[model samples]
Target: MKKITLVFLLIILATTSAQALSWAYPFVVWSGNVYEVTTEEVKNSVISKRIGEVKTKPNDTTGNYYGNASNEYPKGTQYFAISDISTDTAIAVRVKKEKYVKAVFVHKASSHWNPYYYFILFVVAVVLFSLLGKKRFH
Candidate 1:
């Protein structure tokens, strides 16, 4: 029984560590839109330009348009629009990067899954196993 528990813990640790190491491409939020670097070149260029930005806001169900019916740019706002030359996708916008908006601006989808949740679960499992092991030994 002890060996089985030890093996299970090792397996969980290994799998969790592997999952933690896996990297996902980050989504950039700008001008009420979510953009992802579609190519390695664009990723490198954006990093070099220091233009990567992200913002978190309440989920808006309306749409992806920059603004409402008025469609007026905010006062004293300087917009730097970055677009993918090939696909014509808007990548990022400099200035007016509000931190209260979700990254993706699709119709019904929310933000991506957060990896921290998995980490937290792993920690909880480790603690539970340690407690069980101690109780069993005693």
Candidate 2:
């Protein structure tokens, strides 16, 4: 029983570590205080349109839009925007919250993309690469 417990504990630790290491790039769009989603997936995200009226809090997940939806989005998110093909007007925004996931994944402009996490990886790679280069000359 002790052995089994130890193995289970190790597995749990590994799983949690993996999840934390794999941070996602979350992206979001909003129009009139509501997330601009669409009935279909919008491959081309919109850019530079009247942002409407943004009153989002610093890290709050909740937002509202002036537009209204019946049964489609009783919660008030516009799904049609996410399905946009020409997605030129799709505004790109990022909020650190799990509730705001449309397709479960999107390349967001978040702090993860910043030069932070992979900085160590980059240095290690460069050192290994340089050592390999020396082998060729030898």
Whole-model Cα lDDT per candidate? Answer: 0.38, 0.35
RMSD of each: 16.3, 14.2
Query: What tens-digit string does per-residue lDDT give for candidate 2 at 64-113?
Result: 11222111222323233233422343433222221222322222322212
Residues forming the 10-long window of minimal summed lDDT in candidate 2: 62-71
Clash pairs (backbone) in predicted model 1: 56-100, 56-101, 57-100, 57-101, 57-102
lDDT (C-alpha) at residue 120 in model 1: 94
TM-score of each: 0.28, 0.20
lDDT of 1 at 43: 31
Per-residue lDDT of candidate 1, residues 51-95 (tens digit): 333323222343222221112223332223333341134433333
What's model 1's lDDT at 83?
38
Error of 1 at 33 (Å): 10
> Which residues of candidate 1, in runs, are more than 4 Å off?
1-105, 110-112
